[model samples]
Target: MNFPRLQGMTEALRLTQAGQLNDATQLLQQLCQGQAATGPRDATVRPRRVIDLARALPKAIASGVVSPGPAAPRATVFNGTAARPANSPMPAGAAFHALTYSGPTGTRAYRLYVPASYRGAAVPLIVMLHGCTQSPEDFATGTGMNVLAEAEGCLVAYPAQPASANPQKCWNWFNANDQQRDQGEPAILAGLTRQIMRDYAVDARRVYVAGLSAGGAAAAILGAVYPDLYAAIGVHSGLACGAARDMPSAFAAMRQGGAAPSRAAAGQRTPPAIVFHADRDGTVHPRNGDQVLAQFGAGLGMKPERQDGQVPGGHRYTISRYRNGQGEPQLEHWLIQGGGHAWAGGHAPGSYTDPRGPDASREILRFFLQHRMA
Candidate 1:
């Protein structure tokens, strides 16, 4: 481990635990800049929103009403270096509601998105998990999934990871308690899915989960432990399940993709998955994406078809597809060339999205719609 960098991250975690969220985020931003991480180390940096959250965090902390969710040590480690687009108009057409979900593990708040055109018909449901320091609105804006939801008539859910649960607002994918069946975050997320399905006319078989970075790792965990719930999984720049159990190993996985986590016998069932990763991602090594397909695709007993292509005026990419005996693709891995740690083919309205590559949102949904819960 890079001791100096680790020390900085550790201090950031302490700041978050002490309710100094803005300072922690600012310090994290400073550390993200290569040259800044080398210089006066104490350089004060303030991200506009973190400062705003700092004002409200105290109130939430004092009231004791904040949901105990999950958090990360630093946002930059998961969010990347993309700038939030200026004058980007807020998206509409999807009516959103703030709701809460309680399961065997715990309770957490979430936002539900219903298309304006919906009446009373069964539609697909998408459970989107945001990165650290992000909310439903941010993730919605960034991924443009809501806009697609409006067009496609699918329900969308954005689960919040409160500071009380995770000081960094990241899903606790690194915690052992959160990595299993009917336990921890996985249980809570699954419960949230079932709740949404019950409250709305959601097609149980079409339910899917997707997330970025830390959320992506948690998505993998969900697909692994609760394959029956999520028909398909989308992981954008995320690690494989059981990649790490703590900060040390998590950091190791981020730096140099760790060994594939243990899994059940090959005869068992698992959810089909789609992955997006940029070869030039600086935060999470691109090798982790390779590990994702390798880990899950291991037991498939077949070779994946490899194809290469390029997007006009954007990034080049390679697609690796694994197939079942019927020749249907079970896994799709997109390796974007020259892509950083941002959503490929995402709009500028949201953060950490690269609009240069193929549209991941559309492709993932297309891939997801091909599979359903058995």
Candidate 2:
């Protein structure tokens, strides 16, 4: 009902303009709970809309800045000089670094997670992309990836999307510029992945990429364009690659639950993939999960291993695992009944997460480690 197109954000913007950051942050934390609880008063704060508010609020809180309007900072890159809550100090078993990358694609900032057990030995590396309005730290905190990586003796990298690019800090997965192998976001992300591989003792054969929402959509694109780079891909609550090539189509696809099913011919070159989505996902249709799985295991003509169960104390889910002729998993899809447009099994601090029974993060990692680049 508001011209802003996104409700609740208006009041938060007013608070931002008033210089009441702490109050604004608190309000945002409540308004943009990212798949958190909602009631009659929150009906205006739709799940998808809340994701935007949640994402935008964090950028505002961290940067000591705010856009002139509801969009976001105009220039991507790290906000001119915003001050975000420092990420928790890296633990003894692992180290974290905030680094910047400059290339033909321009400058992009990323956070690298290096485990303490590293002594110049090759280990798996995972490139994590954040959704709209999410920072590497927020994603890391919500996913608890570093803890998993530390125990698994692997490396995890978080690439941040500068708000200036999407205004909401969402990856331009629908932008033609960002879809090609040697082009846009694909090139930049690939370059950064390679750079990390070169800088660290990384096992190039075991490199992987995963993301949430827009970030998740981008991950699927990377897998398609650069199968050699990423051994496997994890797209949580995201659509398939090429689901949309523009904004309007992007929204349409989101509503329809992804573009038409993919008809990929299963083979060695086809990068294995795992997807997660919820039945009650208001932001993204549940069928999108089916489409993702279909695309991952397009051909090869293999039957799926299906199982349905509920989290011990959380939501119920259906898991369909597909494998190639060699019995190697090519695709696995998790359909969380009564889920929303959030990362299922994710914890707090990050937006758009539903802390339900089946943990998508752990499941993604488990599926990733099962396959490697040939």
TM-score of each: 0.77, 0.77
Off by over 4 Å in 1: 1-94
lDDT of 2 at 1: 44
For residues 1-374, could you state the per-residue lDDT of candidate 1 as single tens digits? 67777776766655555545445555666777732334233435332222111222323222111111111112211123242342344355447899999876889999888988778798999999987778777888877787677778888899999888887688888788899888888989998899888888988889999998888988999988887788899999888988888655665676678667666457767788899988776556788887777666645586878898876666678998888777767889999888766777766666666666577887887888788877
Off by over 4 Å in 2: 1-49, 52-90, 261-268
C-alpha lDDT values of all predictions = 0.73, 0.71
Query: Which 10-residue window in model 1 sums to the lowest lDDT?
Result: 64-73
lDDT tens per residue, model 2, 178-230: 87878888998999998888898998899999998788888988988888889
Q: Could you tell me the C-alpha RMSD of candidate 2 in Å?
A: 10.3
